[model samples]
Target: VKSLEDFYDMEGFRDKEFDKDDKGTWVVSSKIAIQKDDSSPLVSKNIYLFFNKNNNKATGKFVLSKIYEDFSKNTENEYRIAYSNNKIELLDNAPKEVELFLKDYKFLVEEKSFKSLNNLPKISSRHNDNLPLYSINYLIKQDNEINKWLQQKYKFMKQDAIMNIENSGELSNSSLSNFYFKVRYKGKKEEIQYFRESINFKPSKGGY
Candidate 1:
């Protein structure tokens, strides 16, 4: 876990770049997903690794961090830590509460992709809502945890779903097709409509 060999041998590392120090300022760069949070709804977090001039350890590491409340969400932020002069400093302006948690992340090399089962959405519960629902838009009505997990899973499955939509014939839902719904939001009745044909529906990218 302490040597460059251990790092290079780890699994599920997608892309990589390298450079040598004394010869050309040694560096190794790659991308990986690491579960660096427990309290956060996010489980699979993107991490960018950069190791320059030091092979035994990395010189720069960044984590895709999140800040969310109620239904509003943000994951664009990144928590960065860089190694310099034999010391590592948390460089990103993460919230004070999250800043301290970064200190406990995987400091050593990981042999596998970090997966957080606790945070993963239970598919059964997610799709079992009494109210009729379609993909992302319907998810917003769900609670915070389900909302976060739905957005996360949708981000991964959107392309496939789009392909299905493209190949499939006749998009119709009983509730949507029949146009029979007495659904209300916040005690106010809402009107529902359905179109005979379909258009490429792209859910709001990410932030749900």
Candidate 2:
């Protein structure tokens, strides 16, 4: 999670500027969402500030950087400035005071449920043809080993799960309709349960 002040503090941000159209509406600027390294996972999120020629304050509409892409359109009369990953989205009809208030506000990571299995038996008879009958103690150790392996695998899947949540925009428990864990022995998917928290853009008046 990062704040708008943090965003502005990044190198080259202060120099970024907005471009306007013939009709006086701001055009999407190249300054929006600068990806300097191109190889870096982090990208700059940009908010185009449009203003009246007669007034230094906003004229109304503005354009924001889009999620998963590069651009989105909005108006001050119809939207507020907010961050989502390396992009921005509209917040319906937000006031200037609210926008200013949020200028330094940081985005908090939103948490979602992540599920995988635990306590699975290793070398199940269903899969292994070998009949090396094991003692209860050995079986327990095998189960523990299997669980450890699953945890390692699940860690790799965390990024993908977070990406899915971002793309879908559905954070409800019911919306978590995917699995990343499986048990080879029983041919059954492992049931997992955990929570994922990632920085997400949303309109807020401060407290959770």
The CA-based lDDT of model 1 is what? Answer: 0.31
lDDT of 2 at 165: 25
Count of clashing residue pairs in every prediction = 4, 9
RMSD of each: 17.8, 20.9
What's the CA error at residue 171 for candidate 2, in Å? 52
Model 2 weakest 10-residue run by lDDT? 7-16
lDDT (tens digit, per residue) of candidate 1 on 1-208: 3543333233221112222222112222322232223334432333343442223344445555444443376565567676544334687676764465445333222222214433433222222234332231121233343223323532221111110011111234311111111111121122111111121111112111
Worst 10 residues of 1 by lDDT: 175-184
Q: Please, what is the whole-model Cα lDDT of each candidate in the order they appear?
A: 0.31, 0.27
Candidate 2, residues 1-208, lDDT tens digits: the string is 1323232222110111222221122111111122223332222233333322222223222333323222343211234443444444346665565465335422121111223323323333221224312211112232243334333533222211111122212235322211122221211133223222222222111111
The lDDT leader among the candidates is: 1
